[model samples]
Target: MYYGSVGGNATFLLNLPPDKRGLIHENDRARLSELGEAIRNTFRTNLAEGSSAQASGTMSGHQVDSIFDGNPDTYWCPEEGTEQVTIEVDLKAETEFNLVVLQEHRYSQRIEKLELEVQQDGEWKPLWIGTVVGYKRICWFDKVTSRYIRFKITESRWCPRISVFEVFCG
Candidate 1:
């Protein structure tokens, strides 16, 4: 059996019931293989590859590196009570990409307003600006070539701390 659900309160889950209740019969192997392939194709490329990130500030014991470590359990949080925070990613070289993905810390409403920018002529130019909520946000815009990406948190929740699990451009 394959089980998943989303609820009114931003709930999402994938679970397997008891052995007898959720058993995957031998015939299901083919279906599972197809599902696996679909997932692989969906994430075939991650533009954040070979990139390095830096943030304006990080809360004690939480480092900026956690944001790109591919682990949702780890996160990057700005200093307590910070008014604004900027996290920058160096793409190593100019590359064309149209998507910026931000995954926030689970169960937290931290980011309110975000601005996506690229370094152009030594100045940061806007690519997209919008409000964000929930655990994930995907921003799409016209493709741009730049070596650096600046993710600015212009507004945040009451704590005023910016916390995120992962950020990428693709």
Candidate 2:
């Protein structure tokens, strides 16, 4: 449920059976905790960190290269009047990854739709299309081995302000 819902960009409801006392079974609780820990361990490292990052167009203060700094306060924004833009991340070498994390600054959510693509064999191939990133969105797909990845913002309420973009292997 967690992987499907998160990867498909939908909210999910996980149900765990509870007893008459409104307490979950011991086994179920333990399993749930184990799953949570596994997920945490999988994403503990951001493989895209410190990779070369650049945007099609960049706003002065909100330079796109800062997206990997890990600070939620600083963000990357495209030039004014630009509703669509692309940010390319160079992994420095071929990297294998299956998950991506996107975060929007807390002030507002402007992104309406975006697509992720990978450069394979000198060609760009689509991976996933995401919608409405409010605070944070976690997307996962089949593992991809590539040196270059692109984040294309197709639709937005305005110039999209992105705080963090990260990639993880899972």
Candidate 3:
């Protein structure tokens, strides 16, 4: 499988073909390199403004907790306060997809909540939700059919801080 670290505190899982999977253990160097390229491309396209580094750079733990305190539309939660961050995605086919969200707590000992949503009938609906403890990572998967996708961060104690958030699609 190809895993990407982006978009949230999760790993985006991309299932590889049988041949590719078989080579992972015996030829991990080449397999990992290919996987890295795929992940980079995925982030380049899905992140806001087609810039993953830029998007990530704008957020911190303080930013996340105070997002609503400022302009909700333009303000970003601090990487530490980012209860959850998501991206709206356009998929060509309906399939089971998986991704990981990694949360790095700057002060808090645990994440309050993390979630994913899909646009439905002009509304954003929840597709999945979970919790993370300490400074750890979590994984989630679901079958979805949508042209647009977004990540939702619900609750956190800190104000800002994040190392990275990426997405992987298949």
lDDT, candidates in the order shown: 0.68, 0.86, 0.45
C-alpha RMSD of each candidate structure in angstroms: 5.7, 2.2, 9.7
Q: Quote each prediction's TM-score.
A: 0.70, 0.88, 0.41
Residue-wise C-alpha lDDT for candidate 1, range 1-91, written one tens digit per residue: 1111111123444343435657765556666688668646645777676578898888887887777677767777877787578889887
Error of 1 at 169 (Å): 7.3
Q: Write the per-residue lDDT of candidate 3 for residues 76-159, one digit (tens) a residue.
A: 343444444443444433323455344453443445665667666678877767655334353556655554445544655563
Ranking by lDDT: 2, 1, 3
The clash tally of candidate 3 reads 44
Model 2: per-residue lDDT, tens digit, 6-66?
5444566677779888999888889889988998999899998888888999999998867
lDDT of 2 at 130: 75
Give the distance in Å from residue 160's predicted Cα in candidate 3 to where it truly belongs. Answer: 4.4
Q: Clash number for every model?
A: 0, 0, 44
Q: Which candidate is the best by TM-score?
A: 2
